[model samples]
Target: MNTTEIFLIAMLIIFSLPWLVWRVFNTDYFAPLVVVQIIMGILLGPGVLGKWSPEYYQFVFTPAVVQSLNGIAWWAVMLFVMIAGVELDLAQAWKHRRESGITAGLALGSPLLLGCGAALVLLQFPGWMGPLAQHWQFVLGIGMACAVTALPILILLMEKLEILRHPLGQRILRYASLDDIAIWGVLALILMDWSRIGKQVVFLIAFVLLGWGFRRLMAWLQERDRWYVALIWLAACGFGADWAGLHYMVGAFLAGAIMDAHWFDQDRLDQLRHHVLLVMMPVFFLSTGLRTNWAVGGAEVFAAAALLLFVSVAGKLIGVRIAGRVLGWGPGEASVIGWLLQTKALIMIIFANILLDKQVITSETFTALLLMAVASTMLTVPVVAPRMSAHR
Candidate 1:
């Protein structure tokens, strides 16, 4: 078959397998279609399907087909990240400054500290740290991964629970929004290249000026024109960030972060996100899965993943519990909020992917982190649903 046929075949498999599993197994309550797709990606990767059927894997995922898929995944993820950036309602977060700041700080810092400890333990073993990473870089990267809250996924889950517009849900969004900014800021710090500092500095300055002008332009344009302009901005920012050695995903986030979400229709924005996930993100997941390696041993990877998950969940709960005490939240509020804040699906995966791309963490570590993200996200709805219902 030609490359086109092979790529289509790959896409068909990517889209179909996850849906079949979600429907046939009725995993929606626990494992959403996105979660199933992520697992499916890993299963179809070299560690599982490729190992069992190297010939088939190679034939289906040829170099040309892989490249094609990667292109789609890149744009897909960029758009998704941009949406995440635009969704950041920092204004509301600031309006609830004391509450949001206290919760966001502890929520992020506690996991970071615990995750750093976990990273320290992993460092004792070989095959965990990436080649290009300094000891500090690897440690900090993993720690931050554990601390990350998937704001986009959190929003989705909140909407599903019918609390998206509720006061409690709005408060959760504020906390997550604050943490989201910190997460990206720390990522920029981690990705800083001393050798390319000049370029990065220049990029930042240029980004500010361009952002101001772009925002002005966006305000002037009709909503329909804004969508096209946003894509153009996305491409430009992505290229500039990649050129500055900070990664295009960071650029994508910045591109949307500076823009006002209210400029576009909320329903359209939500639909765009959903369509991206439906059509493009599965390919990204498959590509992500293709990178998973268990050379360090599957048992070790699972163990590490479990350790990360434990610290991630525990730290978030403990930190939020502290905040709850200080703020005098009603009983059960902290637990519910803590569990909801622990959702780490897409953003954590994206963060880990950047780490892997930068060689800040090895494939084994990536696999473990990926597993932790999946497990962490899966736990959110199951744990939080009952709490939310009871609290209501």
Candidate 2:
């Protein structure tokens, strides 16, 4: 078949198989459609499908076809990340700064320390660190990945639990918002290149000045006009960030972060997010799966994933529990909050993807991070549901 035929075939598998499995098996209670889609991405990746049927995998995922899909995936993820940025309730976080800081800090720091330790251990072995990575870069990158909370996925889970607007849910959102900012800040730090430092500095200054004008322009425009301008801004920021050597995704987040969520209709914004997930993000997931490799050996990769998962869960729970004590949270509150905060799927995956893209971590490490993210997210609802009910 031609490239177009092969690409369409690939898209067919990407969208259909995940939906069928999600519906047929009724996995929504424990594994939401998003979680199942992520798992399906893994199953469809080189590690599984390619291993089983090399020729079929290669035929369908030819370089040209993969390239075409990547273009879609890049834009899809950029839009998603930008939305995540716009949705960050930083104003609320600032309002609750003391509480938010304590929770967000411990929650992020503990996992980072533990994850760095794990990275240290992994450094002793081969096939984990990427060729371009410094020892410090590998350790810090993995450490931050462990500390990440997928704010977008967390919001989805909270909405599912019917607590998104509840007091406790709002509290959780505040904590996550602060951590979200820190996550990107650390990413910028890790991605900084001495050679390109000047360019990055220039980009930041220009962004600040242009972002001010952009925000003002957005505020004056009608809502309908704002949407088109926002897309144009996204494209520009993505290009500028890529040019600055900080990655286009960073630019995408900045594009949204600078814009006020109040400038658009909340319901429509939510609908846009839903539609993006429905239509485009599965392509991102498939492309992500396409990047997975088991060259380090399946057992080894699984071991690394298990290791990362343990630290991510343990550190999050430990840190949150500490915060609960300091804040005098009610009995069992920490457990509930901890479990909810431990949810990691999209954001952690995105962070690891950046690390993988920058060659700070090998594909083996990326595969492991992918597995850890899926497992971490899958545990959130099942583990927290009963605890939440007990309290109710």
Candidate 3:
């Protein structure tokens, strides 16, 4: 068969299988289609399907077909990350600086500390850290992965729970928004290549100047014109960042971060995000899945995943509870907020992917982190739903 035919078959599997499972089992209450899709990606990956039927896997996911799918996935994730950046309401976060800072700090810092400790334990073993990583890089990267909260996924979950527009929901956004900024900052630190430091410095300086002009230009353009201009800007920023030895994903985030979300219609921006997820992100998910491995052993990977999940969930809850006490939050507030903050899916996976790409973490570590992300996300709805009901 032609490469195009094989690629189409891959796409068919990517889109169809997850939706079928979600619908057939009526798993919406616990496992949303997104969650189902992620799980399906793992099941379809080399660790599972490829292991079982290497011939069929190779036939469908030929080198050409994989390359084609990767192109789509790259663009998909770039757009998705850009949208996440565009949605950041820094102004609002600033307005609630005290509360947001306290909450976001503890929420992020606690898990980071705990995850670092976990990474230390894992270091005693082989096959966990990447070949290119230094001890500090590996620890910090894994720590930050645990601390990450997927803002996009959090928004989606909040909307599902019918609290997206509520005051509580707005507050959660503020906390998550602050942490989102920190997540990228830490990512930049992790990606720093000392030999290319000069280029990275130049890129930052140019980014700031260009960003100023770009924002002004965006402000001047009509909403209809801004969309096309934004894509052009996205491509340029991504290229510049990649050239500077910083990842293009960072550049994509910056491209959208500087542009005011108000410049475009909110409904249109939301629709664009939804459409990207519907049409493109499944390809990204599949590509991510294809990278999963269990050379360290499947049981070991699951064990590591469970350990990370424990620290991630416990640390978030503990930190938030501390914040609640210090800030004097009402009863049950911390529990609900903590559970919501613990949700990690797209953003954490993206962070892990970057770590994997940078050779800061091995595929074994990536697989474990991926499992933790999926399991943590699945826990969000079930745990938060009951608490939200009680509050209501």
Candidate 4:
């Protein structure tokens, strides 16, 4: 078949197979459609599908076809990340600074330290660190991955539980929002290139000045015009960041972070996010899968994944429990909060993807992180639902 025909075949598989399995088996109670989509991506990746049927994998995921898919995935994820940024309720976080700080700090810090420790162990082995990574970059990159909470996915899960607008749900959003800032801040630090330090510095300064002007422009524009202008801004910021050697994803996040969410109509903004996920994010997941490899051995990758999962889950729970004690949270609150905050789905995958792109971690490490993300996300609803029910 021609490239276009094969690409369509690939798209059909991406959109259909996962939905069929999700609808048929009814995995929503334990695994939502998004989590299932991620799993399917891994299964369809080279590690699994290529190993099982190399010829078919090569035939469909040809170079031309893969390139076309990647373009879609890149734009899709950029839009998603920008929305996550625009939606960050920093004003709410600041209003309850003391509580938010205590919770956010522990939630992020405990996992980071433990994850760094795990990275240390992985460093002792071969095939874990990428070729271009310095020791510190690899360690910090892995550490941050463990600490990441997928704010986008967390919001989705909370909405699923019917708590998104509730007081408790709003509190969780506050904590996650604070951590989201730190997560991207750390990412910029990790992707910092000393050789291009001047360029990065220039980019930051220019972004600040231009960002001010952009915000003013957005403020004066009609709502419909704002949407078009935002896309233009997203593309420009992405290009500037990539040119500065900080990666387009960093620029994408910044593009949304500077804009006030209140500027847009809440309902319309929510719909746009929903549509982006529905239409675009599956391609990103599949593209992520295409990069997975098990050259370090499946058993070894699984072991690493298990190790990361333990630290990520344990660290978040421990840290949150400590915060609960300090703040005198009611009984059962911490467990529910901990489980909800421990989610590491899309954001963690994005973090690992950036690391892999920069060669800070090998495909083997990326595969393990991917597995950890899928498992971690799958555990959230099942574990939190019962606790939430008891409280209700």
Error of 3 at 362 (Å): 0.4
Give the lDDT of residue 153 in candidate 1.
89
Model 3 regions lying over 4 Å from their true place: none
- Candidate 4 off by > 4 Å: none
lDDT of each: 0.95, 0.93, 0.93, 0.95
List residue ranges in candidate 1 displaced over 4 A: none
**Ten residues in a row with the worst lDDT in model 1?**
380-389
Candidate 3 local distance difference test against the native = 0.93
Question: What TM-score fits each model?
Answer: 0.99, 0.99, 0.99, 0.99
| Segments in model 2 whose C-alpha atoms lie over 4 Å from true places | none
Question: Model 2: how large is the Cα RMSD against the reference?
Answer: 0.7
Give candidate 2's total backbone clashes: 0
lDDT of 2 by residue, 1-392 (tens): 89999999999999999999999999998899998888988988999999999999998999999999999989999999999999998889888889999999999999999999999999999999999999999999999999999998998999989999999999998998888889999999999999999999999999999999998899899999999999999999999998999999999999988988899899999999999999999999998999999999999999999999999999999999999999999999999999999999998988888899999999999999999999999999999989989989
Summarize candidate 3's per-residue lDDT along 114-218 as a digit string, tens digits: 999999989999999998899999999999999999999999999999998999999999999999999999999989999999999999999999888898899
